[model samples]
Target: MPAPKNPLLPAVRWALAVLAGAVMVLSFAPFGWFPAALASVTAFYLLLPRGRRGGFATGWFYGLGLLGFGVFWIRISLNEFGNMPAVAANALMLLLVAALALFYALAGWLVTRLRPGEDAPRWWVGPLLVLPGVWVLLEWVRSWLFTGFPWLFAGNGQINPLPLLGAPLAGWAPVVGVHGLSLAVALSAGLVVVALRRGGGARPAALAGLLAIWLVGALLARVEWTRPADGPLSAAVLQGNVEQSLKWAPDGVLPTLEIYLDLTREVLADSDVIVWPETAIPSFLHEVEAGLLPPLTADAVAAGAEIVIGVPIMEMAERYFNGLISVGSAADRYYKRHLVPFGEFLPFDRQLRPLIDWFDVPMSSFSRGEAERPLLQVGPYRVGVSICYEDVFPEEVRQALPEAAYLINVSNDAWFGDSLAPHQHLEFARLRALENGRPLVRATNTGISAIIDHRGRVTASLPLFERGVLTGTIQPRTGRTPFAAVGSLPALLLAAAMLVAALLLGRSRNTAA
Candidate 1:
């Protein structure tokens, strides 16, 4: 139902729209929206009023502001690589933002309909179960719908120093999965707004509840979910920082190979395992192994270390794959299951052939590896590894968890330059570490290479875009966290159940009224 149009209401509506935008911006504040729980609550409150469909307008505006700020770097890709005229690029970019904003619109609409009253009986239940349930449900839906852009789910905001104990108990951090802790944070934020307006002593109770959540996380952090299965393992991660310009040029092959081998040989004395960023080999694996096989294997064996290098594998009949190969003793091979649509392999490559070449896709036609593959074992550790774009997806990494002692991701973000892509990517890896309760070792082509502990803290790192190696002794843990054992099923099921209950409760209340 539309309220009769009031002349001054448009101004008020505009102000609310701007406030919604501010809330979205605050969602990415330094400490994160989770801690303050401000943005989530504001979003809920703004959309809760009856007879006012402000949710759509408010959500769309906020999304425009949030995406415009968070993913502003898309222009770099569109203008620099897509080669679109400015007007066309901005319009397309806005279209993406608008589409993403629809999820928020859905969130707002769900909350409003679930408001407790004569029409809806489960208003209270909405916060208890429906809020977290629907929110996570939407996130999960978004992750797969339209090929997914599961970037920075509300959960990612709860990373580190935030008492992420729920991460291990829930089998993954709420931030890492669709439901988990991040939904819990949103529920709490809504509760906070509800309490504040009621003008009661509930504020203390809310604050205490918030404290308890963090306390639980702190307690869980103390527990070492895993331990060294046998002994210490040493590994070297190579950061080539090769210029994006020459990395794929035919002339870049020899220099790229030489630089990696040179660095590998230098660090061979110190590390038990050596790693290179995704596609560090430049040329296809089968093509380069002829030249790299003999000496590199001998050197690894001599150093008692395994060499894990990222390369492109072109199979018979021109099927290509982004993969990692382990050389020396205990060596095994693993291919990336999740591939980047536009970057690694174009979705519709044949139709987009000219567009692909324009984007400078080095080897853009890679095939996907099996959904399930064995972990790559290096010495005492069974490594669950993901290549390049795989890290962005938390669920995809779980397929490797049971057999793997840790998570290793190798990427080449030279494509994204020094933009927020690298930092944002690194953050995703950290959340994955926390979610799975596994130490994550990430090696990138041009900087932001890091070693993240099970608690999602960076223990060691090498500068981005610099030619060097990160050498560290990492202990492999044995036990599995709740996440490692079950994945997102628990969260998804919970969300589904909440939605069902909300509907039933709403129906029951309407009948009673």
Candidate 2:
């Protein structure tokens, strides 16, 4: 890399960085332009600034492009459902976006800060090794920090990338998890960068490296990490298509209950297990316990069906939880361990609440459930459970695995309105299914209720904002994938090793220089 002679080059690079970030999001969700991710990463490497401050500024702009375009739905939730003023909602969205963009700033700053001066391209260490390491590590950090917003991860783009490409990137998921796959994508992009920058056989070597990754992924896709356990169990996922605006209204409560019950009655006869969306009742469990719970239990027993319904649970005087209870062959309750920040419960309430009156979203004050709540048991096998945002955290989804015959995620995505959020959420569920080698039954309030097999394929699904039941036979799996057994530790270790190796090379270069 050489110093630019053109004064305008800096501004041009910054603009392109922003453009790169904006389009990077296109690789995710409804777009599914996985190749766009490669393009974005290559652009990022080419445009990355040399100075620490410049790198930070460039990364912030890039992040502004990515998250600003990616998570605009947050404003919809705040404005439409939270009753936040449009100006305030936009301001809050920008605030959240800017805060998250700082992580990108850190990643960008690190590139320049940790570089080996002129020798950065020596082992192709700067791009191929360092960039991927830092990128995935930072992404892993974002997944857990501030109770984490692991949405729009780099790996999210690679999962089931175009059918024409034939599962080239997704196969690495079960072996290394989402973070590891993210590293692979980043590494691939870095290889492209290195190929373009160097000559005299370098391009062919990089091309070879790229081909090896793709070929290995394609091969892994053919391997079934887990086997089927028992005959397929019929599962019915209910999507009530409830409107977010009317969900918690005092009068809307009865209507909401009826909608779910009506849907349940329609499918109860054929389903081995009936699953409901989050807070399907729109009321606390105790409120409905007397009139609904026991009767529903009896109805399920009579119909020879098991019911897993999501509702709010109130404990003692103050604690309330977003939860699910089973009414069937065996009864069990699973409270949502991971609560959605601000939506489920506000952080720094004393400071923010007084400053902003609109912080009072309905049911935004629920308490976090115990860490080790029981998995819902239906018939002979245990089902791993996640409520709403919990499924986005891979480790949280991995908790019941190796024992949990299948995975169940109950969510109310109505908060995001009619947007890519639900579809993107379905993508995340697919990743979990593929990662743990378990069939996932995803039930949601607005739409995209789906039955995803262990292979991460959508076997059956309902459309968004539609009232319907998705019934499918999910084969229970009794084994764990490498990911399920070790979680993301291996992925983290690999990323760490890349960073360490890059640092050692950089140090040696500096010492020799």
Candidate 3:
């Protein structure tokens, strides 16, 4: 893929790789330039070394650009909300970005090692098979590694359809899941390489295949994976634009609670389920269990409504968890199954806890909740509930489906301030709703709170950092999507197969030579 040997050729390649990766970030939410996904991938794939230069360096630089620009919001959270020094926050953000970039580094290294010395690898062998296979498998690995930061996935951009195609690529979510789209996105990149490097037949074939992939996603858009279980449930998501600094303040806690109560009381008469943003109550569940919650529960019951709210709760004195609880219709409670690393709990608690004062941010020491906890029962529907970061994981969301009539995710986006995070966070929840064939109710502190339908369409929403009650109707659906029933196994298996096929043929080619 490199040009003629020259002094600046290597530097140029690396620069292009970095720039291409950054271009990929433009495809993601807040930017929503969908075609940039293909252009970025095409450039990155072509920039990959076909000669002696290592692809690993190219890949890491690419990752640095992609993740660096995409998740720069991390610095905002650390500095603005966590009170971390700006310099320290930037350093920590760089540290995380560098560490995660190793996955891409590994992907590039493996692609080179798999089929060495190939200037133009066969269309079926390397371009279509090995590249996408290795790329998305690494994405899967990245999703679960170190409790997963599944942010900035390429598929996140495809939540909307390609411009000319006029089809939502996210339609594939219900079948292959997000990683499948990752694979498809990677394969689309591979197609570009095939078209560029190969002659005659391979070029047309690659172009046709690329069109067909998006065409298939467009066609899949029509399939109804789940049917309605009940009539629309009138829901209200209470978005209290509480400042992160004052949320847990010694004096501001009660007033924050009062803000939600007043908002809920106003909307209860018009809704069946009233939802509050994450940690809207800014206090321990036990501390309020005796006094504040009882009255709130009584109010909801008297008004024929149920309220779902997020709060930190303690059990047995030592076990603290970020929790979600329903009051009035059901006393059901659910703890956040997946806790954010360093944000919710320290990674190496015994050592890391005392070494750094930064990790001591409020509500950072909570323990993980049970994975099989009971669902939040809201009136006649059982809701799949998640807190903050949990909605980003596709499998985690799938685990609650078919049985869960709908999904509710409560988050505190105030941590990220005015950043791309709140917008990107909404896209993931939108994809999950499509993947599982369920309507999603997302209530957030400092907005972009939305009600997404089963088709991954944002039906109604509140703007970022707004103070209001979002009253929307959620049509609960029942039945499983192919993805909901099988999880991500199909996508994983498909990627694994492509990889195995490439490696075996490469082994034979080496043996014959």
lDDT of each: 0.69, 0.85, 0.84
Task: List candidate 3 segments past 4 Å from native.
Answer: 1-8, 116-124, 162-164
Q: Single out the weakest 10-residue window by summed lDDT for candidate 2.
A: 1-10
Tens digits of lDDT, candidate 3, 384-471: 9889899999888888877899999999988888888899999899989998999999999989899999988898999988899898
Worst 10 residues of 1 by lDDT: 163-172
Candidate 2, which segments miss by more than 4 Å at Cα? Answer: 1-8, 51-53, 117-123
Candidates 2 and 3, the one with greater TM-score:
2
Specify the highest-TM-score model's number. Answer: 2
Candidate with top lDDT is 2
Between 1 and 2, whose TM-score is larger? 2
Q: Cα deviation of 193 in candidate 3 (Å)?
A: 1.5
- Clashing pairs counted in every model: 10, 0, 0
Residue pairs that clash (backbone atoms under 3 angstroms), model 2: none
